[model samples]
Target: MKDTKILKIHNKSDKPDNIVIRDNNLIEECIIIEKSLPNFMKDYFVYLKGSVSVSTRHAYLKDIKFFCNYLVESQELTIAKEICDITLEEFNLIKARDVNLFLGDYCTRYYKHTSQDTTLIYENNNRALARKKSSLSTLFKFMFRNEQLDSNITDGFNPIKLPKPQPDAIKRLDIDEVAKMLDSVENGYGLTDKEKVYWRKTKLRDKAILALFVTYGLRLNELRELNISSFNFSRGEFKIYRKRGKEVLMPINHTCEVVVKDYIYNERTKSELLAEEHKDALFLSLQNKRITPKAIRQLVKKYTSISMETSRDSGYSPHKLRATAATSLIQNGFSIYDVQNLLDHDNVTTTQLYAAHKKHVKRDIVNNFEWIDDKKETSLD
Candidate 1:
């Protein structure tokens, strides 16, 4: 782990004690990739490490690897055998047409991965292709900015146009379904005898997790990163770290507050199951450690499948709970701007997409229209 001392203090509360500045695992992963790639690419990763999030850097590395594979297969470039051998002159030979071909071909072909003599073939969708193209564009821009390349070949190529948003694309549960899901969690309606026995032990924690998701529209990572100190009982609020490292405080409702408090004080404190390292974490797995995002997702799927009939069609996940929370707020007469703030969206356009999904607004508008009197009115023929 790397440590940098704080030279300037803007606010005392802003800098928490023992705060992790960078993920050590991510730094180690970047170092491994740096040793494998060419010097220029290594430098590019170093530049990106300072500016972007760990997740973004990880994705860029994967995309660049895909680009290298494309160069080997399509262009018959020997440098692909060892990425470190690729010269600047070879990089400059890549044109906009080559990039176009890469994007087009990626969508149609299968990317094969082999490990332990087992092969897996993955197909790229339009969105995946667009993301790969964006990653390549960022790499080219970096090369041009640093004078490593004479010009950016990716600049002339047109980007892939995404399809317009559809109403059905946003899958969310109705208010009644949300109520049923909560009830099922509390009552253990459809669970097996063995599952019910397990639920009896962790019901409070499970309820708290579900309440937080439906009430605040928390993303999986946001929920997972929560600590016991994050909640302010006096203020009736809790703090969360959002994407891009932005921290925001959100008010807790009566129901969420009750469940979370019950889990923390009644169940969590009494249990001696927690690992010492995860003592400060708000939610814990059966293994007595901080819960993973995958576990939280599976929890949501398990409960929703038992509680809602439309779970098969709508698909229940943590994100779907977020959408349900947004839709419920809109249905309850909150403004789109309010929903945007609650959900922590960077743009109002994303909130507007939820507004488009509100079928009641369209129904009310159509219901208010007066029909012409067929007996009294005549055509102006």
Candidate 2:
């Protein structure tokens, strides 16, 4: 006898009737998982789909899968062998202690597939554990609010307290370092003869990229997503899509405007690598496609490293460029509120961190102490 295949069908109303079938095995696996989920859990994910980004939803799914695996491996719950096998009643039966074990111990020893090979190995880190805890916490809160679970067991689990990140006092470039970086990119300084030749080809584009980072404090994604239409030459402004789906208009400084225009007209337009579809892109790779975030980071690192004296000074990424912009603005007497607006920070507190790191603040404090000491010494003399 032939085995019956379980097929998962999407609600026809939710999608177009003319569906092109592709990747049969992947479709089958998705169908199996969909069929396996309890109705309540399915509803929970459906509710989340309306609110969260695709990447965020993907994390939630992974975290929930890990929780289900814990039930089977640690608790020896036969019903939890498959995620769909776990019932709404079983979820309610989960105590605070069960959740604590999952968040603390299970997360610490979970297997991760290595990038170079298929071998799975245990990896434990505070960041990964904290993310899982947060994911589970979000899930439990959703379940409790929707009455899928009798109580929120995750509420009883203590927060994962990771150590504070060390301040990047040494990592941030001073004003002279920033000037040197821009000068090197423009003049091909510290570059080999071969590199200097390549730098001439990409100088305008590279300068525009660096200028945008220093001037606007754009996140990597925000910069990568830029199109030619994103800039308004007449209005002297540009639009950027920020985190959480925000679109904001930002003013372009005179330096950024000139460099970007020069690249667009002189270098970018002359490139034979530009593809038809990517013509709208503000930046293109050698392949003539929209430049990726990874490529942008590499470019930033390349120029930053050339400006540094040692490897210790060479770890600056695009984010550090963002920090540089914010700190520079704060040091030049821009209000924290203005810096927050420019950085597109939702909260003022985030901008305050940059303000706290202002080099001028430290300098002024030291100078005041010196003045006090000088007064005492003069009085004694």
Candidate 3:
């Protein structure tokens, strides 16, 4: 009898999607860190798991761990050797004044001795300090409410005032720069011989990635988690998962449609070289695996740096690309509320930042609506 080859099907739907799995991993990591802390931390852990996102929970755990380590290192408690050994009674001994010292002084600058001859110095800006303060405040409040601590000393903790972010402070590509970036990806404008080799293979994919970013203003993770099934070309629509577990449908513009279809039909559809595990992924690397966030960041930097004629290290991040989309849409007379919907901004105030950018508004007034120029005001004579 002739042998029949049984081709195995890659059923990605049988398993949880990437976002859920990534979040679950963070939750598991939080659990591990929580177990290493004092038993009373369980209450806070459970609360955070239910109320907050996994990333925030993990970050809070890290902040708490550092604070606990600081207590032991500073000789403030003198009794515990490690965070796990710090008892509830000893924990209760910490006062708001001590927290004030940690946040105000130690947090501003710190040192870690990696080896006998080597050390690393760290600095935290006001924003980072504020978040650390918030993490501590949440933990302190939880402990006080549970009667696990001696008393509420949160009121005494010093405030960390962060400066308001101005519209001028936001960095994004101008309209012409956006076109140049795409052109560079398409035509290899300034790529070196070494980069050109890889560029030839990845240009279509890179173009599609950049197009989706400038058009939809998708976040780093949102773009990273896209799958082939996420796009419905027949309807000119695609799905993106946003923060707080939001799934949004985005309309595919002409540029995105053309570039994406070119990449999919011309390149990505050649599945013979693809890994079974990454079969459903919308983007792939030279290794035939799903693309990583680091790779996307590097590619964006390479293209944007060339487009802006800047150093590679000074290239903008994915978030800045998001800012580019917002400002571009607003500059083209799109409504702030509508841009807010596309960008999935939590509030219109966030979208208002892009709208607040001073593009040609000041220039237009100075050149055309000028009162000081007497040559244009002949009626005044």
Candidate 4:
């Protein structure tokens, strides 16, 4: 008797998709569908099941989306429609020249300043331009694997090199200027409603924030994340959580201890706070959530803007307060190691940036000068 063939169906057409014929008694044939493979391969990274954080996954997804958009906009490549049909020759045709041209044009178009002058060069000569190039380079590399483009296009693509701008020379607040600012804060003279609100609720907050930065050199993030529980008011010591989740504690002398205590007991007690959250959060916003990093940045910017209007000499930011702290500590003879640990720096080199203040260098130069001795001894020797 003749055996019938069996077919595996790939489509819903009248003909069988896969064919099987009798071998001894049975026969078989295989049918392959080429269409769905590209879509499956595009998301291959999602199947790995290895432990990675949500943020990392989000970043990867964002990078892939960026690449897909770039391909469509820059090269007329589409992941769903045109990607599978792309040949190796067609893939390689998407060149570094294209990427560079796209980036250069994109940077030039979006980076303009609004001073009514088209000829004015945008601030493209800095770190932002470099980062835009980096983002493009990274996205291209990701596309080559997932979207099946040539990964080599991104290879050897030189990143834009940007020279670091020299740090604005440290503008230290003089004692008299500090006194004047403090007087303005205390008396609330000639200040706006916003400034008055800042002056009232933020006296202790500002004092504590500034004192901590100027006294111990806290970063903006560190001050924002400070917890009341971390402070030992009796012992005058407070712990600060630094970047990348490290902690350091430094002692406050009696003067700062009084200020902090006064702030906590008198001013901070009135804040509306969130229940079921950490009550120990050292700084609270008006809405009573733990003070956020953005708030800290804004506070610094606002106060500094006000101070700048009063005295350019007091044009201070949180970073300047940090610098002020470093200079003050180094002026009072704090060891570099002490400053490094207090600031929770991973390397001594970063600490050295703060260490090389003009004041300390000048003081050392004057103290080491032998001009008086030379004049007294005369020329005979």
TM-score of each: 0.86, 0.81, 0.90, 0.62
Number of clashing pairs per prediction, in order: 0, 1, 0, 11
| TM-score, ranked from best to worst | 3, 1, 2, 4
Q: List the residue pairs that clash in candidate 2.
A: 36-84
Alpha-carbon runs more than 4 Å astray in model 1: 1-22, 73-75, 111-118, 269-273, 310-315, 365-381
Candidate 1 on 330-379: residue-level lDDT in tens? 87788999999999988998888888766767788787775864547567
Relative to the true structure, candidate 3 reaches a TM of 0.90
lDDT of 2 by residue, 1-33 (tens): 998875444544421111111123344444454
lDDT of each: 0.78, 0.75, 0.86, 0.57
User: What is the total number of backbone clashes in candidate 3?
Assistant: 0
Clashing pairs in 1: none
Q: Which stretches of candidate 2 lie over 4 Å from their true place?
A: 1-39, 70-75, 78-80, 112-124, 165-170, 269-274, 359-381
lDDT for 331 (candidate 3)? 84
| Candidate 4 global CA lDDT score | 0.57
lDDT accuracy of residue 81 in candidate 1: 63
> Which candidate number has the best lDDT?
3
User: Relative to the unseen true structure, what is the C-alpha lDDT of residue 305 in candidate 2, on a scale of 0 to 100?
Assistant: 83
State the weakest 10-residue window (summed lDDT) of model 3: 7-16
The true-versus-predicted C-alpha distance at residue 357 of model 4, in Å, is 2.4
